[model samples]
Target: MKDFLRIKVLKMLIPNQKKELILKQMKDKMNKILNYFKNLVAKIRIGKANTEILDDITVEYYEKKINLYHIARIEVNHSNTILIKPWYTKILPAIEKSILKANLGLVTINNGKLIKIVIPNLTEERRKELIRMNTRKLEKAKIILRNIRKEYNQIIKFNIIDIDTVNIYKKHIDIVTREYICLIENIFNKKKQEIRRI
Candidate 1:
């Protein structure tokens, strides 16, 4: 399935259009999945948040910008609050929608351009439920990664991809997998710490 010579050549050659095209496609595939899970875990961190809303809320802070997700921060004093600070003073309504859409069940109280979010303390049952939800998210990321791998395999099986190319793809897969796992685990640890607090 691989031309050993071609693989060696690809290594030495600056990626021409053909190589660039394949590399771009593979990178896109990798980013699409990696970004999705990272976003999910970020949302999960917000979800596990008992007192703040960090889910999918964005803010429009620039001059007359429309996309609210363009700006947002991830900090709440004492870990029980989320503050949404917008750059634009007029987009409170839109920012509110982003926060609600995030669906962390946090209420946004607007103070001029600043929105305050108070995170609630998690009950034992709720903590367990959040853990379960995180597991599902991780599984979904795995499935997506597999689907991308399958696509790469298709290219390999068709004899279009050389060994070097396949190896490169495999390397990306390994990197993404490790990065995402670390992110997910960090969220888990944070939530577990929160749940353990009496």
Candidate 2:
């Protein structure tokens, strides 16, 4: 039976249930923040180690390798270049062809050894577009935070949880969401600065 009013005892159902529900809400916020900055993360993956960009690339032209992420290592060098070194030289042309099809401003220059790709600096127009994209992502993450609050309210509405306990959960959600938002904004600020450096 469902009780819409009176001591709803949301926690009384099970101690673990209450804890798990709270944890799930927190994870929702975490996922939102992670997804928001996913593209930015890909851009900043420029490190000394050999890692691939286009990690999600798929191959359809020839059944040869199926995807560049599977055959080549993507290394981001400097501020505007991606290095693709196929594990085997035989796939050099295939790699170049794949990149060309991507049309991501990638120019394939093979010195009979390795393929070097130059990621051009984002034009002022592109930078503005990226900024706008991230701002929208942040806004969506905030909206997710609001939805968590609504779920908390549902518990309170039916007296499922006591006032003190509900207050505690509310405070925890607020604190966690604020921290996540801060992280997202900090990342955005760093990327924005990089974009405008030139």
Candidate 3:
């Protein structure tokens, strides 16, 4: 009789444990998706010269591909100019070539010692294009969020102990989903404002 009661208690606790574990996993995955979206947004220039704009550019040095930041110092010399000074002057041309190939709509001036890039003012048409691109990225993030919700719902439906427990988990998942969606919307709005700013 004692053993039967203990078994019953264990069964009750296991489902709760599983629910907590699933919630934690869902939150971790959602955070990763949010960070990815933030990185994508960071790469979109807003008519300013930012060091992060060159973060994706890779230069060939010593017969190996290396990130631009690893070989040189990137700085914003002015509101619209970026200066890249390589530690070894020999790689100046290589860095210049990498930036050119990046096709970021910027012009590079290599002066033997350092490379300079001037960010041009965005025309009205370019601003519209950037907004459209941003909208696409926002849609992609929304789709990822929806997929995560679906996965959690499936897990809760299949593994939960009873209908009541399943409802609890579903409610919690809905709340979390709402919170993350709001966060993404706020980020998108801020980026749009930045792009439209003069």
Residue-level lDDT of model 3, residues 1-198, one tens digit each, is 985674565456555586667678788999998998889887877778888889889999889999999999999999899999999999998999899997677889999999999988899987887888878888999889888998778766755658998899899898888888888888889989988885
Better of 2 and 3 by TM-score: 3
Which candidate tops lDDT? Answer: 3
Q: For candidate 3, report its TM-score.
A: 0.73
**Candidate 2's residue-wise lDDT over 1-198, tens digit each?**
454432255545435466457657566757665664656444533222223456645654346557676766777775556677777887777777776875444456887678887665567776666667657766776676667656655654444346787677667666766776677677777766765674
**Stretches of candidate 3 exceeding 4 Å from the true structure:** 1-14, 18-21, 42-45, 60-64, 89-94, 100-103, 111-113, 161-164
lDDT of 1 by residue, 66-133 (tens): 44435544455555666767666577677876677765546678888677776656667767766677
Candidate 2 CA-lDDT value: 0.62
Write down the worst ten-residue block by lDDT for model 2. 42-51
The global C-alpha lDDT for each of the candidates, from Candidate 1 onward, is 0.59, 0.62, 0.85
lDDT of 1 at 155: 52
* Model 1 CA deviation exceeding 4 Å by range: 1-56, 59-78, 87-89, 111-113, 160-198
Evaluate model 3: give its lDDT: 0.85
At residue 181, candidate 3 shows an lDDT of 81
Clashing pairs in 3: none
